[model samples]
Target: MQRRTWVPIATGIVALVFFALPSEEPLRGFLPDWVSLVLIYWTFALPARMMVGMAWSVGLVVDIVSFGLPGAYALSKAVLVYLARVLALRVRTYPLWQQTIVVLGLLGIEALILTLIDFIVSGDLSGLQRWTAVVVGALVWPVVYWILRRARHLARLGH
Candidate 1:
């Protein structure tokens, strides 16, 4: 099979693992948004294969598996894909530090959107803990990118 095929399979595996991980207080509220990161990463890495529709589908799957509010995560992920597309090329050129900053900002937006949804549905404000995931996600972006980038290269997906 072509490497391009492996990319999405790898992403799906990662996302499932991400959702499967048990949340444990400080960490519970702040574990890096793993699926979100994978969604964002692959969306930008292979826009042709990963786009808004795919993000929505994956988000819905995550919501179903995680028992989150339906459409909340799906919508937020679609929005993130739009934002990532807007900055996709720019993200590729930036240094790892800069890229991490951008990922943090995107994750922040995702958290903010989810928080708004939580307020609408449950009237609970996530407070500062909602941002913990953004910070953690940003810190891990380079590692995720490195591994995925190598996979992309091996798959002959384009530079």
Candidate 2:
């Protein structure tokens, strides 16, 4: 059980590192939501082990690390994980490209959730430009999927 979880937790830490990295304003929107991508990957890869409470905990870490409103990201990430779990069996069999579309939709929903929270919490309405991260996340989903899959294989977690 411990070995089974090690790779996913390691990947989650890597995602959190990227999430916490500082970026200039112009490039901020372009940064892929690494945390969501990782969460989505593991949710698909290890559906039995990657549950909602774990996602909520990671989101709280993201919230603290990014200094965002508390629980904002927690709620969004929890929802993302739930949706991923619901679609996991179907999406897992999808070719990478088709899976990318699903990733885009999932991340888009997350973006909408965050947008709503931001507007309600700070009265800030985000522009469509914010959606760029969603697109980028989807575009890179195959890459993230490949890398994490490779890691899982190397870790002998089984397919």
lDDT per residue as tens, model 2, 39-120: 9988898788788998999999999998888899999999999999999999988988899999999999999999998899
List the lowest-lDDT window of 10 residues for candidate 2: 1-10
Q: Give residue 83's lDDT in candidate 2 (0 to 100).
A: 97
- Scored by lDDT, the top model is 2
lDDT of each: 0.81, 0.89
Model 1 clashes, total count: 0
* Residue-level error in angstroms, candidate 2, position 39: 0.4
**Per-residue error (Å), model 1, residue 117:** 0.6
**Candidate achieving the largest TM-score:** 2
What's the distance in Å from true for residue 96, model 2? 1.0
RMSD values, in order shown: 1.9, 1.8
lDDT of 1 by residue, 41-128 (tens): 7777766656688778877987888888889989999899989988887788888888888999999999889999999999978577
Clashing pairs in 2: none
Q: Residue 71 in candidate 1 has what lDDT? A: 97
